[model samples]
Target chain A: MDDKLMLMIPGPTPVPERVLQAMAKHPIGHRSADFSAIFAEVTENLKWLHQTKNDLLILAGSGTAAMEAGIINFLSTGDKVLVGTNGKFGERWGKVCAAYNLDVQYITAEWGKPLDPNEFKQALEADTAKDIKAVIITHSETSTGVINDLPTINQYIKAHGALSIVDTVTSLGACSVPIDEWGLDVVASGSQKGYMIPPGLGFVSVSEKAWKAYETANLPKFYFDLGPYRKNAAKNTTPFTPAINLIFALHAALGMMKQEGLETLFARHDRLRSATRAAVKAMGLPLFGPDECASPAVTAVMPTGVEAEKIRSIMRKKFDIALAGGQDSLKGKIFRIGHLGFVTDRDLLTAIAALEATLQELGHTGATPGAGVAAAGEVLNR
Target chain B: MDDKLMLMIPGPTPVPERVLQAMAKHPIGHRSADFSAIFAEVTENLKWLHQTKNDLLILAGSGTAAMEAGIINFLSTGDKVLVGTNGKFGERWGKVCAAYNLDVQYITAEWGKPLDPNEFKQALEADTAKDIKAVIITHSETSTGVINDLPTINQYIKAHGALSIVDTVTSLGACSVPIDEWGLDVVASGSQKGYMIPPGLGFVSVSEKAWKAYETANLPKFYFDLGPYRKNAAKNTTPFTPAINLIFALHAALGMMKQEGLETLFARHDRLRSATRAAVKAMGLPLFGPDECASPAVTAVMPTGVEAEKIRSIMRKKFDIALAGGQDSLKGKIFRIGHLGFVTDRDLLTAIAALEATLQELGHTGATPGAGVAAAGEVLNR
Candidate 1:
């Protein structure tokens, strides 16, 4: 009967009980005025979370769909674009752009390293013809636990007179990402990461500059068309039949976030991230990303002696805990501890305790029995 | 506490309580073994429901996205395609194809009229060079209660040496659609319509011939790419982070459908559609579409003396019943009564009674107070 597993992945984080209950309510007609009011309220709250007065549209898909919409809606075929890649998600943006026959100029950094703004600046400066239409960046690279310096990179994009498109999938609500203040032209995010809801809805905030670009952009789009979305959003509705139950869940989850307040929520995520990092360091494991730019949403740890998959398997089989393993090239080298969305300090302590037990069972007993929990507790107290 | 509204729309249909409870469970990691098992089970059940051994991939979006996927995956730019349009969803397919720069040859029919297979044959025979690459049709036009004859049209397509793409959004679980036997190349459907789940997930079944076409098709795609989906589906996973909670809900809903059996499910829908049509006739309202080609999922009624919107308003405001209004050119002229998915005879009777009373309130005194319900009951008894 004890089949409950704690989800600690980066995107599909733990959903609150209230939010789940809201989703379980009876289905409502998407065209009804009642549903339109609920949609309007959720849209306004999402704008508040993004700190943007720009147009925010809700799409029914993963974050990748939102990212694709941002690209296809504002750029035409054969248009030159600059893409910065330091992790898996960043590389995905480059691939999406390339899929539409866009001339992509990629500035890639090694995994686990923060993206340098100077690289983008140099690329932008080299475009003497001013042919580059947009500059794309990822705010939080979930694969390697590095938070790119969006503020600096966006400034370079602005100086070069190119539109700024940012992927805030893992950082929208987990930290302070002011889209308006940063002058981000198009920012895309997902629901399951920081909205404390299940995965279905993707969101995008569009600036006035991006909308103007959309008028001339002709890269072939239908389902992900922003024009229809913009027209319907003014009436508090979506162009297509949206994920209605997910929208209900989002309304409830956004209310909970409003009650907790954005400042308090960001501080809470920061505290949990600090505790997770402290616990990992105390366990004698090396952190993957740089100490200065660690992501508040998830912490990546490099297990020295044991394979990361083995540790994850042991944790799941023994303690019913689900942790995300490294993706792509970093597969057996690193494991991630996600503290995003509805995570608490106690949950982090429990995960750390499970990690300690799992490490001991693997015959890698460098740290004390309760060292990880103790370190996390010290950080919580501070 | 008495705010429970019955959803009678063609989509976002009434979700079963069991499916809702399944969706209320905590989120799971998309890459974990637990999710893979659920996903594999759901995929197999979907294949059974589709009556096809073809590769069926689930995308996280509305049915429109699946329709777009069917077009963009199997045809390149400027490819000639024949589109059959009788209603809103059919025209949507033509619009989607045109958006991608396809040379669309549309065979148009009046609203509420069934699409003629002879027209398609004529169109195909005229293309002496066999230039047409695909033939697209909507199996169930939700905007009008007309189920186009797909089996016959697909035969014409096969004889013409062209691929056939079908949109069965509101027909898959409501009636029999043997994709393999019908020789359908691509079939797309949505979750909310007949899967007894909420909106979000879109399913597309691709035949082997379509796979061959995909190798040479040059249309642009990223998030809706079927290549990665086929590669990852072999391992019981999706290419991107799917709508995890909706997949869980679909798993439970498909199990319920399996228990009910396809024969019984089709009979149930048939019975509901018959009773609904009888009730509307008893209430002195004319049916919109031809009686022989009426959809088993929903029934469209044409009011004689009163406006359709007035009746829908009265039903909603007084009885807390939400009926679907007409779309596009049929607005305020026809109201649809949906009996798809988890609907029952009792629900149909209640809706009929509400309609009768609303008609009386609107000063239409031709029918008795309980005439609609009585007629429906007699049909159910037979």
Candidate 2:
């Protein structure tokens, strides 16, 4: 009980001390002027982090709720939507759409492979009626450590006159995702990822184009309805009782992010990603995604001869480090190392050292002693 | 900002220091054994709090989300449901049902008035085909400070062979709501109200009858689906990333409640309610609801000649006390004082004193000095 494990999972990331303290503060009335001021600041800072001048609404649920909101709020039943599937999250978009009885055209790629922008373009070109209402893509697939090319796919969607809805759950604060620049109509993310807060709040930024669709979109929505959120946002309040403590934590976390600045934040993630990949490669483990398409938030490593679960167990038991296991079909095949949200160079180094020790303990002796640490050190020093 | 305001809103009540400190703890992996144990304990404690052996699942949203889940997961499109509407939350149930395209037969009562059980009984009796799938009622209508007769209405629902869905957001911990004894099919609540925690987590306890209805209910649901929640609950986990910090806070808050015991908790609320009503009467103000039907959680007062908004502003600006303003149609007509959750005798005395001063300051001199506080003290001493 005295030992606290390092949380190196994709989300439920390590929260900053300031954010935790902020959350610990006595709650204020949600409708009070003080709360409105805090909420307004959080909204503006979230916009700055997302690099979007769109309507970003906060929801009190997981990222999946935001994803479901993105789908149901802008499209009706039987509406044609082109969904791209490359990992668990990408497949989730299709499932959400199908649950709402949408007519879905799935564009899938192999797991750990990036979705081809040309495939989406071809699909749009083949739809002679231009009935595809929206094109949904996962910006960073946490499951397989792949970053889909959002700029190209969104451009294709724009050219085809279809709305671009993106799931930026693990990408918003880790890297550059300019919603307005990319012409993304809907971009959704969660607070636990890249925001350095615990999982409770979900955010979605909607474009003017998406609001126009919302005028007539006939999907059933109550709790996830963005209309009331938009209405309440004008007054710096939420339609329902929000997660007030999380909003306090978000305000503190966003202040920290503002102090760090976006460029430095992105570069920090880039450096950590590079250092982690260098360490994994030096340890003779195969990176799941191609180097060109790898995500900056989490890195999935495919063990050659050792059981992935065994390595994770060793890391948890001996090193007190919690690594993310693979999801869906990738379970026990690949283990993930997350470096998102409040993860520092020191933390990454510790994780890398633990991975090396665990791999060695599991009889994977292909790598030289201290090789992985040295590789990561060179990247960190630079 | 130096003067911390006392939060007296219906929800987002003042969180205890122990709960806040518990929430400030570091993040834990949701799938870890540590989190599982905490979650399982929280679930069991919640069941004890709910007084039911049913499946109680925690969700990361407001009470509205839990209400929506209760409606959508047990009824499909075009399913007829009898909805009782008295205040904002009651009307919200019908709106949620309407959003999901449910055939809602609304039994209406005026704001600040409790619904007549005969209306539901008559409506159910008139239905020759027995097609009313469920009867939804708000156990404690926060908007009007009215407590509906759940025991009586549920008896009517049971006799009519209809499921009883209850919204116990403001009633669960403040009063005795034994779901098993009351025969409630689905009882929903939120964390912030009576649980002495901040808002984020919504809970719903589903009975075996509701689970049977779930098998045939065809409403579209993803994030709020109880099927996955039930499957994961066996292992003490959630289908999505829960608001972990709130769960920690809930554990501490529930422990405090357990130590205090349920009978003591209900008596505390009852004492506070009596004190508040006495103070309101002593101040020569009109209580909104009938004395027999007033809620034990909050007391709504209809001030004569003085604007409710002005009183609230005075309370906030001068004394740093926040009293809840009325909602929707009741706005400006009534103001509510909440004494639920972690409120103490000193807090109630202070609120009463402040209310009297504010009323007098607003030129209402009907009441004598210290009369309200003296009345409240008499009740507190008992």
Q: Specify the highest-DockQ model's number.
A: 1
Writing each residue's lDDT as its tens digit, candidate 1 over A253-307 gives 9999999999999999999988999888889889998778999999999988878
Q: On residues A80-131, what C-alpha lDDT tens digit does candidate 2 reach at each position?
A: 9999999999998998998889999999999999999999989998888989
What does the TM-score come to for chain B in model 1?
0.98
**Chain A structural similarity (TM-score) per candidate?**
0.98, 0.99
Docking class of 2: high
Tens-place lDDT per residue, model 1, B47-69, is 99999999999999999998899
Model 1, which residues run further than 4 Å from truth?
none
Could you tell me how far off, in angstroms, the CA of residue B290 lies in candidate 1 after the best superposition? 1.2
lDDT of 2 by residue, B1-382 (tens): 3547897778789999889999999989998899999999999999999999999999999999998998899998999999999999998999999999999999989999999999988998898798999999999999999999999988889888988999999999999999999889999999999999999999999999999999999999899889999999999999888999999999999999999999999999999999999988988899999999989899999998889999999998899999999998888989999989999889999998988889879999778978999999998998
What is model 2's interface RMSD?
Answer: 0.7
Off by over 4 Å in 2: A1-3, B1-3
Return the lDDT, model 2, position B304. 88
- A300 Cα displacement, candidate 1 (Å): 0.9
- Cα displacement (angstroms), candidate 2, residue B72, comes to 0.6
